[model samples]
Structures are given as structure tokens and as C-alpha cells.
Target: MLNNYPLLAKVESPSDLRKLPRQQLKPLADELRAYVLDCVSKTGGHLGSNLGTVELTVALHYVFNTPEDRLVWDVGHQTYPHKVLTGRRDRMLSLRQRGGISGFPRRDESEYDTFGTGHSSTSISAAHGMAMAAKLKGESRKAVAIIGDGAMTAGMAFEALNNAGIPHGGLMGDLLVILNDNDMSISPPVGALNKYLARLMSGNFYTAAREGAKSVLKNTPLYEFARRFEEHTKGMVGPGTIFEEFGFNYVGPVDGHDLESLIPLLENLRSRPGPQFLHVVTKKGQGYKLAEADPVKYHAASGKFDPAVGFVKAATPPKPTFTQVFGEWLCDMAEQDAKLVGITPAMREGSGMVEFHQRFPTRYYDVGIAEQHSVTFAAGLACEGLKPVVAIYSTFLQRAYDQMIHDVALQNLPVLFALDRAGLVGADGATHAGNYDIAFTRCIPNMAVLTPADEAECRTALTTGYQHTGPATVRYPRGAGVGAEMTKPLTAWPWGKGEMRRHSARPQTHGRGTPRIAVLAFGPLLYPALKAAEALDASVANMRFVKPLDLELVVELARTHDALVTVEDSCIMGGAGSAVTEALSAQGLTLPVLQLGLPDEYVEHGDPVKLMSLCGLDAAGIEKSIRERFLSAPLLRSVANE
Candidate 1:
């Protein structure tokens, strides 16, 4: 691979990259872009975004004194080229694997990775902090934030822009914000800002005239006046006016892929002072024709595939994902109920709402990358006697916590939150993991939290939550469950109730010299727990709802058995396990309770099954834990004697 591109092969680090002559950078970028596509194809990670940022990455490293000068990447999926140049080229094969490199930037990963990020619209604020720190310490350092056009839709990005553009205590910091306007953010960009940027890109006359006037009028008395006039006129005509209003010296609508254009502009900006904003236009998939044509499809690869042919359909039809089930249910429910409306925070495809959007355009709302607004928007819809189902990722719901409590739950609105990716999302790692939703939402008043056991239950849970007058959440993990039968109708489950799936074969010996143990499971982890139960001959109960837990069943299981075990996919501290312990304590029943779930520490990126096993949530792991905690030699000997 190295022999294919001599320039890229020699560049082990950014310092090594800098050693190459100026003319060699174009070839280097070409090599880097090709390498990114190659690596992502093999490893199954982010593809289009990485391919887009090749020249920009090369230019930034070439121009800036990184490690000393901080570069914070917003929506860090585009950092593959950055990673490749920063002494991790060889490790590209290990991307998102167990003990391998992360898909996004991690502060601990490298000195070049100044800020760790997984969510969008955060780069500007972090870079501003770094820039301000440099000012306070009196260090000659610069901070640059590279943000995507899609990320710019979020209010947080603008909030940072508002603050960063001005001075603190009458002192300014050297900060630069580069808008990598690929016009894509997982999904196609939306909102007024996207339109405004489109206009900015098309307003070539304003950009050309402004620059032409500046160059020709320099050293003349009218130059300063012309500059002021340019700013004033650009406000009405288009181009840089909005950014200039924020107090930054706005530059470009430059070619991001062209090394010649990107390098010189970046070099000039590197020497400038105060806040600077550069708008660079680039393609999502620059070199690859397939991805360039259909960026949304090639946003990220699910697994290894042939790059030449692009992604092909599997030979066998795969099991339907929970996301797909939700999408299908949403359409079916919408057809029945006129008030049924679906909302997503710029995740039309991710939450499986592409078909819904296609079928019911008026009822679908894609509110860009604003989680806080999505919840409040749903609440407002529900206020008008409409049933709004906010289809969002479980990790993203954390951003709208206050809105969830104050707007929806407080008002007791009929708003159902269909939270996808409810547990340890493998490749995206700890940042994208949905480990805390069960713990967070269950505590809120008027909020009901449901953990469905499988695909069939997921559909039922969704129906139940949507029908409830109060705010409710139904969280399911990413991808397919155990291929459970999902042929059931969209009927509501018994409210806040659970049913025993398996019972102990032995006679009920009420807590006296009995080795009988009962395992209560939540969500899809029930399947694994059932497998574990088979070995131990333990009773298994699918505790459906996490918030209004089945206390009656808990007490019954506790009284009949000598010990009880709780299993879930979320964090053990405040998860389903905690609910069981609390229920037992309230009922004044004490039995040995073993809680099993994700640990307190962050679980890094890996294969989902491997990660579950490592966390002791898989069948083998669960059985091993139950055996160690409950089925000791003394207990086994006593059971043998009985």
C-alpha cells in the first residue's frame, strides 16, 4: 500500500508530512483520500466524510503547528485523514475494533486530538476555550475549529459563534472557525441556514468584487472606507454578511478539495489575529464516484465490503432491525390515527423514518441537529391534542433532558419517545452508547419507561406508550433482536405489568433450605438470561417496564426462591437491577440479589457481541456470573443433599 504512494508512505507524522515540498501535497492528498476509502472499506467505518476532508486535513497540518496549536473537529467522523497523518496510519486497520482506535477523536488517543467529541456542533466552543487559554497563559498558539455545514444547524454552534466572535474582559483570542460545507451531515442538510449557505456559495459576484476591490484599493485612503462599505453592502447582496455580523473576519467559500486554494488561504489565515471564519466547499465523497453520487448510503459502512462494487445486498435477507420495526409501526399507526405525527432531530434515515417521511410528509418533522428543540416541539404538538412520537437515539435524548422533564413529563403530555440504540452501540463506542436512558427517564414524574424484550414486544411497547396520556419512553438497542416473531398486531401491552416467561420446575420451598433462584431480565437481555437460566434451572421473568416495575412478581419470586438475579443491558448502578433492589427493599424481603449489566467505566468500541460478553451480559457470561454469585459449592452440595 505504501509503495503505491511514495509521498504518503514517507509521512509517518505531521512533521514528516511537513518535510515534503509544496508541490507534493496534492499527490499526498490524493493518496490520503484513497487510503481513507481503502481503510474504511476494509474496517467498516465512516467513508464519505473522511474522503471529503482529505485536502483540508493535509492543508491544516501543513499550515498549523498542531499539538502546540489546537484543532478541534466537530462531528469527528471526518478525522480519518487526520488520524492517518498523525502517526496512526498503520493502525487504520484496527479502526473501531476491540482495543483499536475510536471512530471519533479521543483526547487520550493522541496529542493531535485536542478535544474528544462524538456529538455535533461542539467544536467552536472547545476551540474557543483552547484559544482563550492560550491568551490567558500568554502563549503564542492558535485554535482552529473545523465544523460541518450540517452541524452548523444546531443552536450550540451559533451560541459558541456569538460568544467567540467578541472579546472577554476587552482581550481577544486568536481563533479560527472553518466551515467544511459538504452540505451533508449523515442526512442531507436542512433548515434556513442551509439555504443561506447555498446562497452564499452561489453569490460569486459579491465574493469576487469584495476581494478585487480590497486588492486594488489597498494603500489608498478609500481602502478602509471601501472595506466598511463592502461589509455594509455584502449584508444585503449575500456572502459573509451573517458571519461578519458575528464580529469575525469572514473569508472564502473556497475550494476545500483543491490543495492550491486550501493551502495558501490556510497559511494566510494562520498568521492573522482575532476570530476568523473560513467557508470551504467540498464534496462528501470526493474521489469515489459511487459515494459521491449517493453520500447518504455510503455515510458509513456496516461491515467490510468490496470497494469497487460498493455496498451490495446480502445473499440472504437479514433479520429486520428494531429501527425498521419502529419505522413500519410508525407508518401503520399513522394510517390509523390522524393525530399521529413523527419527529426526528436530523435523523430521518437513522431512526428509520425515511419511509414515514415519504408516505406522510405533513406529519413528519426533521428538526435538524437540535435535540432540545425536538422534545419541546413534540410537547407543543401534543399540547394541541396531537400524539407526537419523537424518534431519537437514546444517547441524544440526554441533550434534551430538561425539556423532557419540564415540557413533556411535567405537562403529562401524550408524547412517546422511541429511543433507538438503547444499549452499548458497538463501533461508535462509549460516546454513542445508550447506557443511561433507563436510569435517567425512570426517575422523572409522569414519565413511563418501557424495556421491550424483543421485536414483537417493541411494537407493542410503542403502541402502549403512544396511547398513554403521560410522557413515555420505549428504548430498544441498535440492530435486530433475537429474530423474535414480530407478526403481532399493534396492540397495547398491559400497562406497567410483566408476565413470567419461565417458572421453576421444583416445588416452591419458601426461602428455607432451597437452592432455587429466579432471574428477572429486562429488554433483549432476557434471551441471554433465559439461556443462562436453562443451565442453572432458574426461573426467568421478562420484566417489561423498568419504571413501574412488576413489584408483585418481584415479591413472588423473592418469597418462592432463596435468591434472585437481575439482568439488563444498561448501567448496573441506576438501571433495571437497581429498580429490583429498590422494590425488594420497599417490600421488606431480603434475598441474595446479583445485579448484572454494563459496568460503571466506559465500554470502548468493538463488535457488539464481544462487548456484551466482556460486560458479562451474554449467555455464557450471565451463566458464569450467576454460578459464581449463587451456585457456590456449598449451595450445590446442599441442593444435592435435598
Candidate 2:
């Protein structure tokens, strides 16, 4: 159940928020923080980011004229508060559900969501484009890009700042970049501006004089003196000088948690001209004590749990997840070889490299939020005769497509890419779904694209890929395995090979001879294909390798069966199913093929189990689809006569 916040419950939209008195805004932010923790504990979404952005979200909405003035949220993980203030408060209960609102911002969902974003560091670019568009059209509207410190490390964010440095009208104006600096580890400001801004923001006299101070500084020679003073004071302490060189008027290291301070600063910056960079300092999980201590663990939440007690690590362990399986295998592999290196793009926790990093800190490399660098960096390590295993998500790997192809595949480097979350990622939806990796990786030269059926096979796939003398990928689905036990010892599977999961003795005909049918499945889809095969009395071939399709098995099976049906968790177009067809076509074999996978359209957010059945990849849906198409009267008539 969604918790009702007295102040927050009253405000239906940003217009309602603007109506509240300045004093009530503090109480409203407090209520909003509690409400997010309450709703997310029940429904479960991005918690740490939303908790961190509560005050900032309130301050921005209260100051700016949104809908008219566009605000782009980078990555959209911290948008729970933004969603609440923009007429989606009631929809918070159904957050990331099938027919409800998305976890990330969607253009179709609302006009407030200026640009749909799930990937990081595109906010500045999108907002800058909007500012230029507004300037060209002669509209008096501002565009602000709210980005996190992690997101700013991305090359795209820096590129956008560079682009905005030289604005459309040949002067720095309109575009505002609000860097939400939650990470306290990044060299903080030791100067008076931190205290100066904080003290000035607290009082009404300074807030009143802030607008006039801007005019005097812009017109008079005192402007350069004030700039020099700020530069000399916070040059080394803060990252202001770096942004200043990028042609932005940098202001802050301000108190983001204090509504009294953040609100007044936002009001002043609202009217200020030129490329303004406001660096707000806030803590992840500010209000909640337990979450504040360990923000990463509380980054996302699920089911009911009191904010007081917090998330107690589940004692009675459930099934081993695919991620956990990889983590265990990585440590084992690393222990066996000193030349082994593990790399992640700011996903030390998500990519299951925690233990690997802890055990071998020297070998573990967190390249921050730069995926492109992570891939090319691995190529460099492999060039120096070291085995580098890149632990990256299937969705994030999209950002480093060039490095994967040019640096790794082109040179035929011995780099293993462990692409976690390889199928439909449920609540994360289309933006995060890893449906294209199979198609994308298979097409590249010197790339071994392998998919594992269960937890046991996942470990083997990783081993098989790591030992291979070329660029190899082992893509696995998110969440726990299908009650499959993982092997203690590590071993590599045979290269470019697949095994028969289920084989029916003969084709079932209603008192007549009928042609046999076979289902060729890749990865997790093999379970459902096996289930569907039982009903049809068909054989199930688990084709693990996508690029090197087991031609020997496929040719023999095609000759035995009249119709061939291929199934995968990825998209039907150019997916593993297409690989089977291409192999058959090369040998001039005219086998009737049916391909089943995620359709042409993007799959929406929901429970992964439910989404599977909806996509016709589950047992019942797979059986119904197969029997309806392949088991047709006309197609099987010639075989039935035999």
C-alpha cells in the first residue's frame, strides 16, 4: 500500500507544489521522502536514487515552470519524486507494472518526460538540443539537464557540455546543467563558497539581493574579480574549475538536503542567464539511517520491510541466481591463474564482481560509467598476455558496440564478455531488455556467441568462452536458475556443439504415418521447448552456440524431421532462429522453418514469468503455437499418407 503524505498527498502536480508556501516546502520534501520509501518498500523500484533526489526534485519543480520549460533526467533512476510531482503520484502504487507507469521516463507516458531515457549521460545532449530548438523558434523557455556524478563520467555528457559551451546564438545561455553530486568521495570543496552559499541560502536578505548581484557582476568590471575570487577559493577543492573551462558558470557544492538552502538557490538560478552548472551535494538515502549507511544494498527494494528494521539479508537462501553462478566461477578461474583480470563499467555490484574485486583488488578494474573504455581496456590487457573477462550487462554493452567489434573482434583478442541480463528484464522493460545481443554479437567476425540453458551450463559457458583464443560472449538471463544445481568444479563445454535434450522415438499419427518434427532451442528457452516437445512427441535440440551453429546435428535433424522449429528468448528477427535458417540455406536444404521469440514490437514492463507466457515462449504458448502451425493438415498430409 502507498503511504499517504499529508503535504505531498495534497499536491497533485507541480502547479499544486508551486501553490504551497516556502515554509511548507520543507515539510513537503520530508513527506515526499517517507512516501517514496513507503511505496518502494511495497512495490520495489529505484530507492536510493529517489531518496537522494527528493529535495532537489521539490526545489526544481517549485522554482521552474515545467511542461513549458523542459527538464531532462539522466538515466531516470532518480525520477520517482519527479513522477510523483508530475500527476503520477497515484500511479506510484503500480510502479513498473504491466499496464501502469514505467520505472524510467517515457515520452508517450507524459509531456513532462521531455526525452525517454534509460541509458546514462544523454540528458545534457537532449536538453541542449531542446534549448537550441527553443532559441531558434524564439520561445522564452529554459532547458535543464539533471545528471548524476556517475553519469557525468560518460563521454557523451562531457561532449554535450562542450556542445553547450558554444551555444546556438554564439554565446553561453539557456542550457543549465545540474550535477547531482551525491558521491561524497569525489574531492569536496574546502573553501568558503560551500559555507558562503549555504549561509547566503539560509537568509532572506542574500536571496533578495542574489538577482541584483548577477546584474552588477555582468555589467561592471567587478565581475572578473568575483570570478577570480571564486576560482582562487575553490580551484582545487571543488570541480568548478573543470566545468568553468567547459564554458559553464559553475556554482555550488551547495546543501541539496536542506530545502531552505536548495529552494532559494534554485529560485535565483532560474532567472540567471548563460550555461549554468549547479553542483548540489546530497546523500543517497538521506532520511533513512540504515539505507544511508549502505546505499548500494538499498539501491532497489522489494516486498514489505520497515524503514526502521531495514533489509535483513535473507538467511534461508533460495535458488542460486545466474549472476551468483558467474561470480563463483570467476573467483575459481582467477585463483587458477594470476594473469586473469576482471573489468566492469561502474557495475561492481550489479555485474556480480563483488567477491572478485574483494579477493583480487589488483586485478579488479572499475572503469566507472564508461563501457566503451572497459572493452578497449580489456583489449589492451589481452594484448599484454593477460586474460581479461569483462563483466557487463547486455543493455549497457550497447553503448560500447564499436570497442567490442573494432578493438576486440577485429584483432581477435582473447577477451570474454559475460553479458548478464540477456533476455526480457521485466520491470526495466524495453530500455533494459537484452534481446539484441544474440543477433548483434553473432554477426561480428571471430566472436563466439554462447548461451546457457541453466545455472550449471552458465558456469561452463563462461569457462568455454574464457579459454577460447578469440572474442567470445556468454550471455545469461537475469534472476535465479530453474532449480538446477551448480557444479562445484569448473569445466569447459565442447566448442560449437549442442546436445539433444529430448528425443521422441517416432512421429505420432492418428492411424497414419506422419513426418517427425524437431524444436531447436537456445539458452533459457530450452526449458519451454522441452515442455512443448512432450505434447507434440517431437525432439528438442539445445543449440548453445549461435555463431558456430552445430551444422552436423542440424543437417542430420533436418533430414530426419519434416519441419524445423527454432526458439530463443531474444527477438525473432536476425536472432538464433535466423542462424539455423541461414545454416540450412547455405547447404541448399529447403526445410520448413518456424521462428518464435520476442515480436517486432517492444515488450512492456511486468513480472518476468508473466511476460514469458505473453511472448509465447512458455510451455503452453509454445505448444499451442507449434501444433497450430507445424501440425497443420495440408503440411503433414503427404507424410501422413506414408
lDDT, candidate 1, 1-642, per-residue tens: 777777789998889888899999998888888888888889999999999999999999999988789999998999999999998999999999999999999999999999999999999999999999999998999999999988988999999999999989987889999999897332232334443443353345545676688899998999999878867764543367888889887766666777766676677777777898888778998899999999999999999988899999999999999999999999999999999999999999999999999999999999999999999999999999999999999999999999999999999999999999999999999999999999999889999999998989999999999888899999999999888887646799888889898888866554354478889999999999999889888999999999788888888888777778899999998888999999988876676788999999999999999999899999999999988876664332224212
How far residue 523's Cα lies from its native spot in candidate 2, in Å, is: 0.3
Taken over the whole model, the C-alpha lDDT of each candidate is 0.88, 0.86
Error of model 2, residue 202, in angstroms: 15
lDDT of 2 at 467: 91
Give the 10-residue window scoring lowest on summed lDDT in candidate 1: 633-642
lDDT digits (tens) for residues 191-246 of candidate 2: 55575754453345653565567687887899888768757765644567888889
At residue 173, what lDDT does model 1 achieve? 82
Clashes of 2: 0
